[model samples]
Target: MGEGNFNWSNEVLTRLISQAGLIALKLVLIIVLFFIIRALGKKLIGSAFEKYQKKNTVNAGRIRTLEKLSINVFSYALIFFTVVTALSNLGVSVTSIIAGAGVVGLAIGFGAQGLVSDVVTGFFVLLEKQIDVDDYVTVGGLDGVVEEVGLRTTQIRGFDGTLHFIPNREITTVSNHSRGNMRAMVDIGISYDDDIDRALSVIQEVCDKVSAEDSSFKDGPNVIGVQSLGASEIVLRVIGKTENGMQWAGERTLRKRLKEALDVNGIEIPYPHQVYMEKKADI
Candidate 1:
């Protein structure tokens, strides 16, 4: 009986050693497969993406995100297939496993509908070019420059330097500020007593000089004439079209340069004032 027990222990030890060896082999093989998938994906899918980016002149941020996403996706695909192959080597029936997975996936699909929708929407966004990295946009009440666009979400950096992560599915309407030329608007205030025609002429002269100096101005920096008569001033509106991404800068420059010009030319910009009366002084 002791001899039999010794033989049983030997068998158990041998089996344990064999199982450990197989697991180690599988792990090594999986690691190799992971790298192989990454290399191939970069050469194949990533190469295609790179070419597309070059052709479309897509921003670098989008290109990098896409390349990374592609490599990861391929790595996962390789891992899945490698595991199945390893299982088949160990006498596991892949057919039965696939069948089981199909059912499980169907159930998970129903339960994770929102997640699936987000991924689907993200893919569409990438393919359709509805949005791209570096695009200044307003979406879902958040306005920012797109930092990264991913399969599940979009990242934006606001003017205030805040980073925002927005789910792709939640982005219903997008206002792309960099699509075309932008408008620069300025309403110059002058005292109501100042000559409207002369004030307009001065403002127009400033606009022309600014436009000529800065090529950012795409269209007329024309004076649109009097917009409103305020409490103590006449608001003369100045309008200009500037190249994409230069609107804000142009508007700021317009204000600074116009103010200086007005100041130099002695244009009277109005200030709030009050008058006082004394009955005794009048007598």
Candidate 2:
């Protein structure tokens, strides 16, 4: 009786060890397959975009934006399926769990409508080409350069270097500034006493030089005559159409050149001033 009991106990122990080994082996295989699939999926997505770009005259930035979106979608789906598979491998009844989740999700769907709206809105935004990565845009009352556009949120880097993640549904109106030629306008003032005709002539010479030399300027940087009469000066507005994203730089260059030209011609750019009078305490 004792020998029989020992043999039975040993058999049970061996069976449990064998089952444990099989489960471990399965987990390892599952993990390996997950990594392999993720890598292959990203590689395939990138390859497809490159091929499409080569065959079409599509905008390079738009292609990059779509490529990133595709990769994000692929990764999200792959991770979800991988987690489900891993859970099933651990002896969990995935089918029953999924059914239970479906009921819970249905109940919670109303409160989560914003998520669905975000995804839908994002889809249309991408489809309509309202904005793209690296675009300077004003959306959701915020102005910034778009870094990424995802299903849930779009990333914006502000001029002051703040990174913002805004939901897609919040982007009701999009003002894309990087689409085509941008207007560069600079308002420089001269003293009310300075010669208007001389200032205009000096500015026109500058404009002609810029139009001839600066490749960024697509249209006139011509002096647009007097814009306004300020308290101490006459404001002259200079306008130009320049390459997208170069407006600020073009304005800076204009201001510098205009200042030099005005100074060389003795046209004083005015500023606020105060007159001081000394009162003697006792004479």
Candidate 3:
């Protein structure tokens, strides 16, 4: 009887070792598959982006965002499936766990409504192409350049160098300034005593020069006539169309050129002036 018990114990030990080895092998295979899928997924996303970029340079930012999102989604999906398969191989009931998770998820769905909304909104944002990475936009009352559009949130870098991560659902209205040509408007002020016609002529000459030298201008930098008559000066408006995101630079360059042209022609930019009078009390 003692001999028989020893043989059974030895058999049990060998079977346990074999089971452990099998589990280890399965785990290793799962890990290797995960990495392989990750690498292939990234490569596919990169290739897709490259092809789309060659066809649509203007939408490069959107394409990049899409590529990043696709990679993230692919990685998560692969990891989740691989882990579940590994668990099943290790004698765990993945179907039961998934069912339990579904019940729990249903219970928590109400509390996670905002998260769901954010995800849904983000998906639509990607589909609609309302805003793209690097696009200057005003959304949720904040103006900035979009850095990333993720599944749950969008990142924007403000002009003040502040980075804002806003939930996608919060973005109700988007004012995209990078879609088309932008208007560059500069108002020049001159002393009222200055010749209006001469000032206009000088401004026109400067505008023509700017239009010729600067490639940013899409339309004529023509004088839009007098904009307003201020208390101390007359305001003349210079209007032009520039490629998106180049309006500010165009405006700055045009202002500098206009100032130089006016200075050369002896046109005075108006400034606040006060004449003081002093009367002796009763000399």
Error of 1 at 124 (Å): 3.8
Q: List the residue pairs that clash in candidate 2.
A: none
Q: Please give the TM-score that candidate 3 achieves against the real structure.
A: 0.84
For model 3, residues 112-186, the per-residue Cα lDDT tens digits are 999999999999998999988899999899999999998899999999999999999998999999998999999
Candidate 1 weakest ten by summed lDDT: 64-73
Task: Rank the candidate models, highest TM-score first.
Answer: 2, 3, 1
> Per-residue lDDT of 41-141 in model 2, one digit per residue for the tens?
99999999999999999988798899999999898888889889888878899999888998899888889999999999999999999988889999999
What does candidate 2 score on TM? Answer: 0.92
Best-fitting candidate, scored by TM-score: 2
Clashing pairs in 3: none
What do the candidate models score in CA lDDT, each in turn? 0.84, 0.93, 0.92
Per-residue lDDT for 205 in model 1? 91
Mark the regions of model 1 whose C-alpha exceeds 4 Å error after superposition: 32-36, 39-48, 51-79, 82-94, 271-283
Candidate topping lDDT? 2
How are the candidates ranked when ordered by lDDT, highest leading? Answer: 2, 3, 1
Under the 3 Å rule for N, CA and C atoms, how many clashes does model 1 have? 0
